[model samples]
Target: MKITVLGTGEGGRLHAAKLSELGHEVVVGTRDPATTLARTEPDMMGNPPMSEWLAAHPGIALLSFGAAAAAADRLVISGIDGASAVNALSGIKEQLTGKVLVDYGIPFNYGVSGPHPWPTPWGSMPTFAVLDSDSLGEQIQRALPNTHVVKAFCTQEQATVVSPGDFNGGDHTMPISGNDPEAKAAVVDLLKSYGWTDILDLGPLVSARGQEMYSHLHSAIGFALGGDRRFGLKVVR
Candidate 1:
C-alpha cells in the first residue's frame, strides 16, 4: 500500500518509519521538504537521501503537509495537532472523497494555557476534555461529506501506540468506530499490520463520542498509574 504520512512530529515520523519497516511504500510528508531532507539525510545513514527514499519507495511516497492529504490513496490517518486539524483538511477534502479517513486527532487547543481544552461539544472530562460532543469523528465526517470516517487509537498513549509490548499484562485491545463496514475492515487490517491483534469494534461512528471520552479517562489513568503511558483497556468475557 502507498501511504503518505502528513506531519513531521513524532507521531508522523513514527508512522512513516513503522510503515516503511512493514514493507509498505511509505512517504512522509512534512511542512518543509528542504528542512526534512537536510535533517533526514544524515540520520538516514546516507541511504540515497530523502529524495532517493521517495524515488526508491515509489508506491510509498512522502509528501508535504498539503500534498500528503491531496494525494493519499485508500487510507489517510491524521495525527496532526488540534489547531491545524480543520485547516489541514480544508485543501484535501476532495482527494479524501470516497476514501477512508482514520482520525487520531485530539481537540485540545494548545496555544491557550494549562491542560489544553478540547473543542466544543467535547466537554470537560476528569483530566482532558470530552473530545466529542457529537464527536470529532462525526465532525470530520460531516465536514468531508464524501469520506468515510472512523475513530480509533485515540485513547492509547503515544508510547503504547508505537510499541504495545511494553505493557506487561495481557494483550491490549484497540477500539474502533466507523459507519462503513468495508472502511472499518480496511482500518482493522492496517492495525493488524502494526501487530495489533486485539481490536474491539464499538459499533458505528456514533460510538466515537464514547471513544473520544475514553481518551480523557485514559489520560487520568496515565497520571494515576505513575506516568506510564503503556497501559490499555481490556474487555474480558
Candidate 2:
C-alpha cells in the first residue's frame, strides 16, 4: 500500500514508522520538507523528530503535503491540532479526491494553557473548538468535497493506536465513523492490521461529533492517569 501520513509531529512519525514496518510504501507529509529534515530536536511534545523515526525505518519517505498526497494511494491524516484541523487538509484537497483519507485528529488545542474549559454559562460542559454544530471530520469532508475521509484512531493515544494488542490481550473498542463504506472499510483493514480487533462503526460522518468530542473526556483521563497514555477506553459490554 502506498500511504501518505501527514503531519510531522509524533503522531505522524509514529504512523509512518508503523506503516513502513507493515511493508507499505509510507511517506510523511509536512509543511516544509527542508525544515523537517533539518530538525534535530524533538517536536513540541518532546517526541524525537521524524528523522529519528526514519533512521529506524530506513526506507520510509518524506515529502511536502501536496507531493506526498499526490504520490500515495491512501492518506492517514495525523498530527493535526483540533483548532486547525480544517486548514491542515484543505491545502491538499484536490490531491485527496477519491482516496481513503483516514483522519486521526481531535479539534482542540493542546498546549501550556492546557484544556479549554467550557464557556461561562455552560461551564460544566466539556471544552472544544469544533463541536455541537460541526466537527473536524465534517469540516474536512466539506472542504475536500471529493475526498473520502474516514475518522478513526482519534480516541487512542499514539502508543495505543499502534500497539493496542499489548494491553491485556487487546480487548478494547475504537470508534470509527464516516460517510463512505468503501473508505471506512479501507480504514478498518488498516486498523485491523495494526491489531485493532474490536471496532465500532458509529454510523455516518455526522457521528464524528461524539467521537471527536470524546477527546475532552479522553484528555481528562490522560491527565488523571498521571499522563500515562498507554491504555485505551474499551467498551465493557
Candidate 3:
C-alpha cells in the first residue's frame, strides 16, 4: 500500500514513520519539502524534526503537496489543526479525488483553552469552531466530495494511535465515522493491522461530532490523570 501523510507536525511525521515501518510505500507532504527536509534541530516542542525521523524511515519519500498527493494510494490528513487541514487540502482538492482520506484533525482552535476540568470552578467552556452543525470530517467530505473521507485517530494521543493492545483490558475500541462504508472499513482494517482489535463504526460522517467532541473530555481526563500519553479508551459494553 502507498500512503501519503500530509502536514508537517509531529502527528503527521509520526504516523508516516510508523506506517512506513510496516512496509508500506509512504511519502510525506509538506508545504516546502526542501526546507522541511533540511532541518537538523528538534521541533519547537523539542521532539526531533521530520528530517531526523526520516533517517530511520529511509524508505519514505518527502515531496510537496501536489507531488505527494498525486503519488499516494491512500491519504492521511494528519493536520495539526482542523483549519490548516481544510486550507491546505483546498489547493489540491482534485488530487484527493477517489482516494480514501483518513482525517486526524480536531476541529477546535488550540489557542483558546480547552474545557475546564471537572470539579473546578466552572467558567468559559471550550467550544468547537465546527460544531453543532458539522465536523472536520463533514467539512472535508463537502470540500472533496469525490474523496471518501473517514474520521479516525483524532481522539487519542500519538502513543496510543498505533498500539492499542498495550491496554491491560485487551481490545480498546476505536470509533470511526464516515459516509462511505468501504472507506470506513478500509480504515478499520488498516487500524486492525496496526493492533487495534475492537473498532466501533459510528455510522455516517455526521457521527464524527461525538468522536471529535470527545476532545474536551480527553483534555480533562489527561489533566485529571496526569500527562496525556499511555492511555487508551475502552467501550465496556
Candidate 4:
C-alpha cells in the first residue's frame, strides 16, 4: 500500500514511520519539501525537525502536498493542523479525488479565547472553531467532494493510536465516523493492523462533532493523570 501522511508534525511523522514499518510505502506531504528539510530547530510542539527524523528513518519519501497525494495508492492520513487544514487540502483537490482521506484533526482555534477558558502549562486551552453544528471531517468532505473522508484517531495521542497494546492490553475503544461505509471500513482495517480490537462505528460524519469535541475532556484527563501518562478511554459496554 502506498500511503501519504499529509503533514510534518509529530502525528504525521508517527503515522509515516509506523506505516513504513508495517511494510507500506509511506510518503509524507508538506507545503514545501525544501523548506521542511531546511528546518534546524524543533517544531512548536518540541518534536525534532523533519530532516532529523528523515535521516533516522530511511526510504520514506517526502514530497509536496499534490505529489504526495497523487502518489498514494488509496489512503491518505491527514495530520495537518486544524486551522489551516481546509485551505491546504483544498489546494490539492484534484490529486485526492476518489481516495479515502482519514482525518484525525480537532478544529481548534487557539486565537479565539473561549467563553470560559481552561488554563494549562502551555496556556489557555484552545476552543473549537467548528462546534455543535459542524466538524472538520464534514468540512474536508465538502471541500473535496470527490474524496472519501473518515474521522478517526482524534481522541488519543498518535503513539497510543499506532500501538494500542502498549496500554491495558489494547482493551480501549477507537471510534470512527463517516458517511461512506466502504471508506470507514478501510480505516477500520488500518486500525486493526495497528492492534485495535474495539473499534466503534459512531455513524456518519456528523458524529465527528462529538469525537472532536472530546479533546477538552481528553486534555482534562491528561492533566488529572499527571500530564504525561499514556492512557486509553474504553467504552465499557
Candidate 5:
C-alpha cells in the first residue's frame, strides 16, 4: 500500500520506517522534508549527520503545510501533539475526503502538572477534553464526512502499538472502533501486517470514547508501574 506518514517526530518516523520495512511504499510528509531526509539515511543510524541523512533518502517527500493531506492512500499522523493533529487535519479536510484515515491519537494535557487526575465518572477514565463531548476520531469523521475513520492503536503505548512483542497468555487485543466496516477491516489488515493477530472490535465510532478512556487507564498503569511503556493488558478466557 502507498502510505503517507505525516509528522516527523519519533512516532511518525518510527511508523514510516516500519511501513517501509514491511515493503509498503512510504512517503514521509514533514514540514521540512530536509529534516526527514537527514534523519533516515543508511549511515545515520546512531548519530546521523544531518546533511548526509537528508542527501541520502531523497524519496522522502517534503510537503508544505497542507500537501500531506492532499496526497496518499492512507494518512497516519503521529508524533505531533493531539491539537496539532486536529489543526493539521482541519486545514486539509477537503483533501481528505473519501480517504481511509488510521487515527492513533490520545487526548493528553501535558500542561497539567502534579498528580494525575481522573476526570471521568467513577468507573470511567479521563480523556482529552475534546473527547468528552465528541472524540477526536468522531470529530475528524464529522469534519470530513466522506472520509472513513477507524480508531485503533490508541490504547497501547507507542512501543507496544508498533511492536506488541509475543503473545504470552491469550492473544493480546487492540480494541478497534469504526462506523465503516471496510475501513475497520483495512485497519485490521494493517495491524496484521505489523504482527497483530488478535483484534477486538468495539463496535461503532461512539465506542471510541470508551477506547480512548481505556488508554488513560493504560497510562495510569504505566505511571504506577514506574514509567514502563512496554507492558500491555489482556483479557483471558
Candidate 6:
C-alpha cells in the first residue's frame, strides 16, 4: 500500500515512520521541500527539523503537496496544520480526487482573544475556528467533493493513535466518523492494523464536531495528567 502523509510536523513524521516500518511505500508532503530542509531551528513543539527526521528514516520520499497526493494509491493521512489545511489542501483538489482523506486536524484559532482565556505553558488555549455547527472535516469534504473524507485521530494524541496497545493493552475506544461507509471501513481497517480493538463508529461527518471540539478537553486532561503522560479514553460499555 502506498501512502502519503501531508505535513512535516511531529504527527506527520510519526505516521510516516510507522507506515514505513509496516512495509508501506510512504511519501511526506509539505509546502516546499527545500524550505523545510533548510530550517535549522526546531519546530514550535521543540522537535527537530524535517531534514533530521528524514535522514533518520530513509527511503521515504519527500514531495510537494500536489505531487504527494498524486503519488498515493488511494489513501492519504492529512497531517496538515489545522489553520492552513483547508486552503493548502483545496489547492490540490484535482490530485486528491477519488481518494480517502483521513483528516486528523483541529480547526484551532490561536489568535483568538476572549473574555475568559485559558492559558497553557505555551500560550492561550486555542479556540475552535469552526465549532458547534461546523467542523474542519465537513469543510474539507465540501471543498473536495470528489474525495472521501474520514474524521479520525483528532480526539487523541498522535502517539496514542499510532500505538494504542502501549496503554492498557489497546482497551480504549477509537471513534471514527464519515459520510462514506466504505471510506470509514477503510480507516477502521488501518486502525485495526495499528492494534485498536474497540473502535466506535460515531456516524456521519457532522459527528466530527464533538471529536474535533474535544481538543480543549484533551489538552486539559493532558495538563491534569502532568503534561508528559500519554493516556487513552476507554468507552466502557
How many residue pairs collide in each prediction? Answer: 6, 2, 0, 0, 4, 0
Candidate 5 residue-wise lDDT, 147-197, digit = tens: 888888887765566677643533577889999998888888888877787
When sorted by lDDT, best at the front, the candidate numbers are: 4, 6, 2, 3, 1, 5
**TM-score to true structure, per model:** 0.77, 0.89, 0.89, 0.98, 0.78, 0.98
* Highest lDDT against the true fold, candidate: 4
Q: Write the per-residue lDDT of candidate 4 for residues 1-237, one digit (tens) a residue.
A: 999999999999889989999999999999999999999999898999889899998999999999999999999999999999999999999999999999999899986667887888788888889989999989999999999999999998999999999978988899999999999999999999999999999999999999999998999999988958899879988
TM-score of 1: 0.77
Candidate 4 deviant stretches above 4 angstroms: none
Model 3: residues with Cα > 4 Å off, grouped in runs: 75-77, 113-126
Q: Tell me the deviation in Å of residue 177 in model 2.
A: 0.7
- What lDDT score goes with residue 166 in model 4? 92
Candidate 6 lDDT score relative to the true structure: 0.92
Q: In angstroms, what RMSD does candidate 5 have relative to the true structure? A: 5.6
Which residue pairs come into collision in candidate 1?
25-60, 27-61, 27-62, 28-62, 29-63, 121-133
Candidate 5, which segments miss by more than 4 Å at Cα? 32-59, 74-79, 113-127, 166-170, 227-229
Candidate number with the higher lDDT (1 or 4): 4
Query: What lDDT does each candidate get?
Result: 0.70, 0.79, 0.78, 0.94, 0.67, 0.92
Q: Looking at candidate 6, what is the lDDT of residue 177? A: 89
- Model 3 residue 28 CA deviation (Å) reads 0.8
Task: Give the 10-residue window scoring lowest on summed lDDT in candidate 2.
Answer: 117-126
lDDT of 6 by residue, 35-135 (tens): 99999999988999888888899999999999999999999999998899999999999999999999999999877847788888777887788999999
User: Tens-digit lDDT track for model 3 on 1-237?
Assistant: 888888767777767877877888988888898898788898776778777777777888888987888888765555546867777887788888898888888876644545552343343444578887788888888888899999998778755777666666445778889988888888887887778878889899899988888987877777678744466677888
Clashing pairs in 5: 37-53, 37-54, 38-53, 38-54
Instruction: Give the C-alpha miss distance for residue 66 in model 6, angstroms.
Output: 0.3
What TM-score would you give candidate 5 relative to the actual structure?
0.78
lDDT string, candidate 2, 36-143, tens digits: 878888876787876777787788888888888888976565566666668867887787887888887777644323355443222344346678988888888899
